[model samples]
Target: MLAIECAGLTKHFGDLTAVDHVSFEVEKGERFGLLGPNGAGKTTTIRMLTTVIPPDEGTAKVLGFDVRRKPDKVREKIGVVLQGLALEFFSTVYDTLDIYGRIYKMNAENRKKRIEYLLSEFELEDKRNERIDCLSGGLQRRVQVATAFMQPPEILFLDEPTIGLDPQSRRKIWQFIEEFSKGGYTVILSTHYMDEADYLCSRIGIIDYGKISALDTPEGLKSTLGGGDIITFGVEGNVDLLRSTISKLDYVEEIMAGDELAARVENADEVLFKLSEEVVKAGAKIKNISVRKPSLEDTFIKLTGRRIE
Candidate 1:
């Protein structure tokens, strides 16, 4: 069954259109991602699908229930971990989770077993007695996510779940998501981190300016950029001249400008040698140079004409 079906979904904030005519489908057991930088409408799309806010136009259905007409039914089958940390600050880790289980109408015995299991799984067993305020930001996030699973809803909506987290914390969250997805659950995650989307999502919809610019699997999206390696030159000066100069190179297929000007080029030693020589003549000094395979970031850059930060 399709986990989500959205067509021409739009949301407007007065003068500005937050989500403009967006459409996509997510299948059961799939890890789907809405990828873009902040203010790109990733969060807005999640809000509409989760029935947190009604869409200004178009339609959205979650697990076959229309979000606008059957919001309660939709909520019954989904779990939401929003951008904000929605945990009780004064409660201990154990009480926080146990209370949520109670809210979900779980039996006493079931709550105990489930809480124990979650504590162990989330590595919170040692921190069970500690107050949530005493835990680190990462642990608090982990606790917040655990609460969403109290009901063990069919679908989970994660909006930049690891935004403020450290690298280690982020990896742990990714691992948890990977583990949960193994049980055939559907997860729709929104993120601006290229590696996060590329690693966790089965297919990604690249959102820019509140619209999906492109939607494809990570490898599929990279393949669309064709056979090329991204050669980035850290230009010290005259970047504009360097961009214009590199665009004319016979071996350079496409170029993108940013802090470090990057080019998608045919991977050959001759191409690299000449590209460096041309950069110098263009009055730019190459502070650093690196060559790597084309990635989802490259695909995004090509689509939106800039890099995501």
Candidate 2:
């Protein structure tokens, strides 16, 4: 079954359009990612699908329930971990999960067992009795994540879920998410971390300026950039002049300049050699140079004309 479906889903914030005629489908148990720079409508799209907000036009269904007409039913089957930390300052880690489980109508015994399991699963056992406000930001995030899993919702919406987490904590969360996916949980992951998306998502949609710019699996998206190495040059003189020369090369697929002059070419060796000669002809001295295979970041840059940063 399709876990989520959207068709021309649009949202406007007065004078600005936050999500513009977006459409996509997510399959059951799939790890889907919404990738974009800030203000690119990634969060807005999640809100619409989660039934947190209504779309101005078009339609969305979460697990076959219309978001606008059956919001309560939709909410019942989904869990959300929003962008920032959301926790009660005075509640202990144990208390927080216990309270959430209670709200989900879990019985006392089940809540107790579930809470204990979650604390251990998320490596929060040591912080069980500690008040949330007294924990570090990472621990607070762990509590928030654990709370989301309390009811075992069919779908989980993770918005920048690992934003401030330490590397160890982040990996642990990734492992949990992977395991959850294997158990038939659908995850909609909205994150700025390209590597995280590449690591966890089965497919990704790149959004820019409120529009879906590209959609594919991580490798699929990277392949669309033509399977070339990205060559970056830090030059001492005449970057524009150097860019003009590099852009003329037949093997060069694309070029962009910011702090450095970068080009995508089919053969890095041939292009780099030609580029070196061109730079010298332009009276530019190469400060540094590097060539690497295409990555999700390169795909995003190709689509948006800039880095995600």
Candidate 3:
């Protein structure tokens, strides 16, 4: 059975449409991702699927329960970690986890054991006595996510779960999510970070302007960039001339300039040799040139005409 489904799901906020006829499905035990920038309908889609809010139009289901007609059934099987902080201000770490487990009707012995395990897993044993509000932002974020696992949910929803975490803390959470998903659990996480989506998700949906523009595995999405490779050139002089000269090449399908000049081409070897000649003719001194596989950022630019950020 599919873990979640959204067919022609739509949501509107006054004059703006937050989600527009969105459609997708996630298989059981799959780590699915919603990749998009802020206000691009990622959160709206999650909200509807989690039964936090109803879609303005269309149908959605979680674990085979229709979100609109059987919301309580859907809610009974999922865990949600929202973007904003939802932890108690004065509760200690131990109390927070214990309280959540208690609400799910977990027995005392099992709840105690789960709390102890989570305290160790989230590296929060030292903070067990500390109030939630007294912890650092990243630590508090960990506590919020930890609460979701208090009952071992069958489906987990994470919306920008690591938005404010540092690099080290971010990787820690990534490892945790990866490990947690191994026990036949389904995860649907929404994130704007390209690397985060690439590293964590088995499949990704790229959303923009209230619509899902593309959906595929990370490598699959990269392969859609005209089946080409990326070549970036670092130059010393005549940057514009180099760009113009490269742009005229027959093999160059797309050329862009930022801190450096880059192009997407069908054949890397042929394009490199030809571009080297053009650089000399254009009066530019070559600093460096590299050939690399196409990336998700490249695919996003091709589909959305801008970076996710």
Candidate 4:
């Protein structure tokens, strides 16, 4: 069964439509990502699906339960880690988790084991006795994420799970998320980090201005930009001649300029050799040559006409 499903799901605030007829599905054990810039209606969609808020139109179902008709059942089967820290500052890490476990109705015997496992798994064993207020931002985030697993719900909803974290902390969290997904749990992650989504999500849906702009696997989306590599270089002489001569190659797609001449090509090595020869023929020498494969970031810009940030 689909772990989560929505059809023409929409939400509005007075005159503004926060989520405009968005629809998608997440299968069991799938790592689904929602990609968008700020105010792209990603978080609003998550909130509705998690049943924190009701949609103004259409329908949503989580884990076989209709969100509009059975919000409690949906909530019981899902876990959420929202944007900010969601812990009580006064409680110690262990106590915070213990409290959450109790709230999930976990019995004492199971709750104790779950708490111990979470502390160790998240690398929070060292901070178990530390008050939530005393922990670093990364540590606090770990605790918050661990709390979500108190009940180990079937579906997990994460909104920007790694925001404002250091590289190490972010990777650690990614590892935890990966391990969690391997246990056959569904994860719906919303984030602005393109690399994170590209690495973690099996399928991605990009939203813009409250609508889905694109939806597919990372490679599938990148292929829409021609499935080629981007070649960039600087020419010391006669750039116009170089552009005119090199643009004729069959593998070359198009050229753009910012700090240097960039050519989108079907193959980097093939075009690199041809481009170098063309530069010499045009009486220009190449410098600072670089090759970049198409990425989700490039696709996002191609679709949204702007960067995710």
Q: Evaluate model 2: give its TM-score.
A: 0.95
Per-prediction TM-score to the true structure, in the order listed:
0.95, 0.95, 0.92, 0.89
User: Which lDDT value does model 1 have at 124?
Assistant: 93
Query: What TM-score would candidate 3 get against the native?
Result: 0.92
Per residue, candidate 2 scores C-alpha lDDT tens digits across 160-232 of 9999899999998999899888999999999889999999999999999999999999999999878878898
Q: Which should have the higher lDDT, number 3 or number 4?
A: 3
Residue pairs that clash (backbone atoms under 3 angstroms), model 3? none
Clashing pairs in 2: none
Model 1 agreement with the true structure over 281-302: per-residue lDDT tens digits: 8888788999899888888888
On TM-score, the stronger of 2 and 3 is 2
| Model 2 spans with C-alpha error above 4 angstroms | 269-271
What's the candidate order when arranged by decreasing TM-score? 1, 2, 3, 4
C-alpha lDDT values of all predictions: 0.90, 0.91, 0.90, 0.89
- Please report, as a residue range, the 10-residue window in candidate 2 with the lowest summed lDDT: 251-260
Pick the lDDT winner.
2
Runs of candidate 3 with Cα error greater than 4 angstroms are: 226-228, 234-244, 256-260, 266-273, 283-290
